[model samples]
Target: MGIGGGVFLGPVLLLIGFASPKNIAGICSAFVLVNSVVGLLSHSLQGRVDLSVLFFLGLVVFAGAQVGSFLGTRKFSPLLLQRIFAFILLAVSLKLGIGISG
Candidate 1:
């Protein structure tokens, strides 16, 4: 299911009596990193990569991730983080469901 695994994983963890959100978050990050690298390598081998676009987007994402990691390390509310992740999952679901039809 590729990245869609997260959509299932978070809830399953919660349902299985895992109350620690931080552990889930850490696991998700590790999952993302491993999957993204695998995807990137596959795409690159298929000559689907545009290095310029990749560089620019990577720079933006890296900076944003640094800021987010910093904030996440601070004493913010866990509920707020969960709410934000839920919104992100919802948006991604909608986008994927609404494919362009010819």
Candidate 2:
């Protein structure tokens, strides 16, 4: 599952079988939420939690999520969304591969 369970699980889940895009998103969101909470608690107890940065980043994430959620459900079709997700995964994989090799 790497460092974040959802990051690993999402693609694996998609590949293992077929599911609707809505179902994939919902499941991944729930998976990430649980993983995030566990990670947060672990860091917080170790006094690694940075409140100031977290607050600012949280706001930015919230804004982006508002637009993203709207667009994902209303603006883009499922096929387009899947293609975008694939592109993002490819980009991330390439970056990671390069970083590791370098």
The residue-by-residue lDDT of candidate 1 on 3-80, one tens digit each, is 537666776786796766667776777777777888889989999988979989999989987887877768558888
Q: Report the lDDT tens digits of candidate 2 across residue range 24-84.
A: 8768877876887788888989999998799898798789878878888889898998898
Write down the lDDT of every candidate, Cα atoms only. 0.76, 0.78
Alpha carbon RMSD to native, model 2: 2.6
**Pairs with backbone N, CA or C atoms under 3 Å apart (clashes), candidate 2:** none
Cα RMSD to native, each candidate? 3.2, 2.6
TM-scores for all candidates: the values are 0.74, 0.79
- Give the candidate number with the greatest lDDT: 2
Full-model lDDT, candidate 1: 0.76
- Give the number of colliding residue pairs in candidate 2: 0
